[model samples]
Target chain A: MIEVQNISFAYKKRTPVLKDFSLSIAPGGIYGLLGRNGAGKSTLLYLIAGLLKPDDGKVLFNGVDTRLRKPSSVSDIFIVPEEFDLPSISLKKYLSLNSRFYPNFSEEDLHRHLDTFELTPDLNLGALSMGQKKKAFMCFALACNTPLLLLDEPTNGLDIPGKSRFRKFIVSSMNDERTILISTHQVRDIDRILDYIIITETNRVLFDQPVSKILSRLKFMTTDKQQLIEDALYSQPSVGGANIILPNTDDIDTELNLESLFEFALVNPQALIDAFTNNINA
Target chain B: MIDNRFRISRTFDLFRLYIIENRKFLLICAAAIVGILICVAISIASDVSYKRAYSMYRPDLDPAIPYLVPTYIIIGYIFAALGASFMFSELKSKQGRIRTLMVPANSSEKLISRMLVYVVLYTVFYVLAICIAEFFRDIYLMAKMTVAPVTPLYTIFGNEAAINFLTTDKYPILLPCILFVGVFAIQSFFVLGSTLWYKYSSVKTFALFFALFFFYTISVFMLGSSLSEGKTYNNLDHFMSNYFGYVFLCFEIIVCLFNWCMAWWRLRETDVITTKR
Candidate 1:
C-alpha cells in the first residue's frame, strides 16, 4: 500500500539522512520497523505519512504522489508521531475536533478505545497524566480509522498494563482494509503484534520478513558455557554465559528474539544476508 | 463528486476545534474587557466623564468621539490573542495538531475558519461592552435631567439605526479582524524562526526579530529596502498614501500569505520528529 523508491532526504545542510532508501509495505498486516539511534526510521515514516516531502526520488501511496498532500492522499494516512502535543481541551472536544477530519472516525469506537485506556472523555486532556495523554492519542488515532496508520515510538510512555493494552488494541482496533507500520528502538514492546519485521540501516532496508518465516530460518539462544554454534553470525556475552543467534539449517523449533536479530543484523550484516540469500522469498 | 463529500467544509470544523482549543483563553480575554468597561461605566455614572484617552481610561467614553477608541482597543486585543493562540497552538501541538493539517482539507479553509470564529466572537463581546458603556451614559444623563432635562435615547446612541449599523458593521469587525490578522501573520514569522532553532524558539523569536530588523535597517541605510523602507510610514495614512486602504490592506494580505507559505515549507523541510533522534 506504501512505496518508497530510492528516496533521499536531509535536514538543511546536514548529511543525507535517507540515502536512496527503498521499501514496499503492503496492506492488512502489522509491520515492526527497527533501526539504530540514527537509522532514519522516523524520517522514512514521516515521508510516507506525507508530513515531509522527500528531497530526491519519490514516496507514493497507492501510486499517488505523497508530496502533493492532497486530501485524497493524506486523508487515508495518519501518523502518531513520537511526541504529540495535546490541546487544553476536554476529551469530548478533542474527539469532536478530529472526528470531522476522517469520515471513518466512529464516536462509539472512540468511547470504547478511551474506555480501554481508562481515559474519561469528559475530562480535559491537559488534566490527564503523560501516560494517560499518550493513551488518549492512541485511542484517537485508532478512531481515525485511516487505511494506513504510522506510529513512531508509540510504546514509550506506557507502563506494563498500558503496553499490554496497546498490543491488544492494535490487533483488534484496526480493520483488514488498513496497513499499520510502527517504528521504534523499543522493539520488544510491539514484538508480539508485529506480523512482519523490517530492519533499517545505512538509509535502506536491511531485512524484511514475516516473524513466522524469520523464526524458521534462524535460532536465538543464551548460553552460559560460552558455547557457540558453527554457523553463528554474531554473539554477545550474557550474565551467566552468552547470547547467540545462528542460521537455522534445519527446521528446529526456536523462539524469535527481535532485539538479538537487530543486534546480529547490525554487527554481521553480510553474514545475516548470506545466510538468508537462498531463502529470500520465504 | 467525491470531492463534495471531502469538501473544504473543514473550516467550520476547525473553528470548533479552535474555540475548544482556546476556550479558557477566550474566557480570560472576555472577562478582562468586560471588567474594565464596567468599571469605566460606573465612574461615568458618578459624574466623572471625559477622561483623556491616554491619561486615564474610564469605564466608557463620550459616545461622541469620532472613532470608538476603547472598542477598537479591546477588539484589537481579542484578535491579537486569537491569532497568537492559533499559530502557537499549531506549533505547540505539532505532532498532535499538525496531523490535522494533513487531512484532505484546504489550507485556506483551515485558516479562514479560525479567523471567522475570531471575527464573530470578538464582535459579539465588543458590541455588548459598548452597549453597557452607553447604558452608563444614559444613567448619568438621567440624573442631570433634574436641572438639564435631557432624553436618554438621543444622547446614548446619537441615532439608533446608525448605532445599530456601527454595532453590526462589516467594517468595524472586518478592519480590526484584518489588523489582528496582520499582527498574527507577522508574529508567526517569529515562530517559524524559533522552530528552526532548538529549545529557545521563544527567546530566539525576539533575538531573531531584532537581529533581522537591525540587519535590514542597517542594510537600508547602507544598501537599500527589504526590511527598512523609511521613517515616512507610521500609521495607515502614511502606509496607504492616496490609494484606497483596501489596496494597502491587500498588500498586507500578501505579506501574511508569504508568512504562511514559509511556515508550511519550514515545517515540511525539518520533518521535526526526526530531530528526536
Candidate 2:
C-alpha cells in the first residue's frame, strides 16, 4: 500500500507538475495511471519509489516515508522505467549480485518468467535488444516479489506478441499481497489488465475510480441517432456511427473501452467525477 | 521495525557488486600499466651498445628507479581520478541513475562501498601492477647484462644511493607520508566532484581544480610576499622544515576529511533529475 499526501513537486525553474496532489493506493490489484505528456506520471512513480524527493509533503509506502529510502522499504519496492541500461554482464551474474538484496527474490520464479518470455539465464543482458532487455528486466522485477511494483511505459518497446506475453506474465504473477502500478499513454496495451484507473492532468488528479464504478455510472456505446449523439457526454466518430459515453441509465453491463474512457475523462472530467462519486455515495 | 541502512552485511553486498561489476575495467587498467611499462623497458633495452655502455658507467645509478617513483605517483593519482569517475558512471544517464538509486541499499552503504572500490581497491591493484611490472623489468635487465651486471633490485629498493636519498632526514618517510595524505585529499576532491557533475565529470572537475589552483597559487604568492618578515631564504627554509611541515600535514588531513564529507553529502542529496541535469 502507498499514500501520496498533498505532495507538490517541480523541476528546477519549471512550473510545478504536481500541486497539492494526494492519492492512496491499497494493496493488491493493477492500477493504470493515465496522463498525457508532462502530466507528471513518471515523476509521481519516481516519488513513490523514493528516487525523487517531493518539493512539499511526502510519499509513504506502507506507512514508511519513501524519501528516507530505508532499505526495508526500498527492497520491497521495484520500479521498471521506460528506459534502463543493464550492466554488461550475463543475466546469471546480474541475478547473483543483485537478487540477494531482496530477501524474497525467487530464482525459480525468475526462471519461470524468463521461460514465458523465451529467455534464459545464460543470456548476456547487455547484448539483448531493447525489447528483449525489457522482458528480462520485467521478469527479474516480478521475480523480486516486492510488494510494490511501479512500471513506466512498460509496453513501449514490446512488440505485439511481447505485449501479449507481458499481459499474460503479469496476470500469472499477480497475487493477493502485491500492488502493481503501471503508468503509460498507451492505454490499449494495459487497459484490459487494469482494475483501477487514475487519470492525471498537469497539476491535479482528474479521475480515480475502479473499472466497476466507472462502468456502473457511464455507458460506452456507439450510436448513429442524432438525439443520442447530441445528448452524449463525449463522442468520437467511428465507422458506422459515433462511439460515445453517456449515463448508464439502463444499468446494463458492458465492456470497458479504455481509449474512449481516457478521451471522455480528459474532455468531460467533472461529469465523469460527479457520475462516479454520486453513484458510489448513493 | 526493519532497518538495514548501516548494516555490515549489506555493505558487503554492495562491495561485492562493485567488485564483480568492475572486474573487467580493473583488469584493463592493469593491462594498460603493464603494457606501458613493457614498452618503456623495451625502449631502454633495444640498443645493445647503449645497454652495455649504460650498465658499465653507473653501478650507483639504476635508471628504472628514478623513472618508477614519479610514474608511481602520477599513475596512482591518474587511476584514482579514473576510479572516481567510474564509481559514479551510473549518474550519467536517466536509466542508469534510476537503477543505481533503486539498488535497495541506503545512500551511506552505496557511498562507502564505492569508496572502497575506487580508493582502497584501486590503490591495491595499482601497487600490484607496479610490482609485477618491476619484476619483469628486473628480469629483463639481468638477462641483458653484457658488460657490468645491472643490479636486479626492485625499483622500490633502487640502488643504495637512491635509497639513502629517499630515506634521508631532509626528505624522510614523513614527507612521503604527508604526500600520501595529500594524494588522498586530491582523490577526495575528485570523488566529491564526480557526485556533483554527471556528464564529463572528470574533465569538468579537472578544469575546476586547475582554475582554483591558479587562483590559490596567486593568493598564496601575494600573501607570502606580504607576510614575510624580511627573513633570509635559509631561515625560511629551516622554519618550513621545523614547523611548516606539521602545519601542511594538518592542512592535508583537513582537506581529506572535508572533501570526503562533502562527497557523502552530495551523494546523499543526489536525486534522479538533479544528476541527469
| Candidate number with greatest DockQ | 2
CAPRI band for model 1 = acceptable
- Look at candidate 1 and tell me the lDDT of residue A125: 86
For residue A156, model 1's alpha carbon misses the true position, in angstroms, by 1.3
> Which tens-of-lDDT digit does each residue in A139-225 have in candidate 2?
999999999999999999998999988998998889999999999988988888898999999889898988887787888888899
List candidate 1 stretches off by more than 4 Å: A111-124, A224-230, A279-282, B1-8, B37-88, B96-104, B136-277
Best by TM-score: 2
lDDT per residue as tens, model 1, B1-277: 0142334466677777777777887788777776766565545444433333312332133333323444445555444443333443444445644555564565555545644654455656666766666566567656554332222233544544334433323344445445555555545555455345544555556676668658754653453222344433345433333233455356457756776566556544444344432
Residues A112-187 of candidate 1 have per-residue lDDT tens digits of 8877876677878888888888888888888888888989999998899999888888988857788899999888
Looking at model 2 chain B, report the run of 10 residues with the lowest lDDT sum.
B46-55
- How much is A94 displaced in model 2, in angstroms? 1.1
Report the lDDT of model 2 for residue B161.
56
- Residue-level lDDT tens digits of model 2 in B97-166: 8877888887788988988887787777777766676677667766766453344335446466556544
lDDT per model vs. reference: 0.67, 0.80
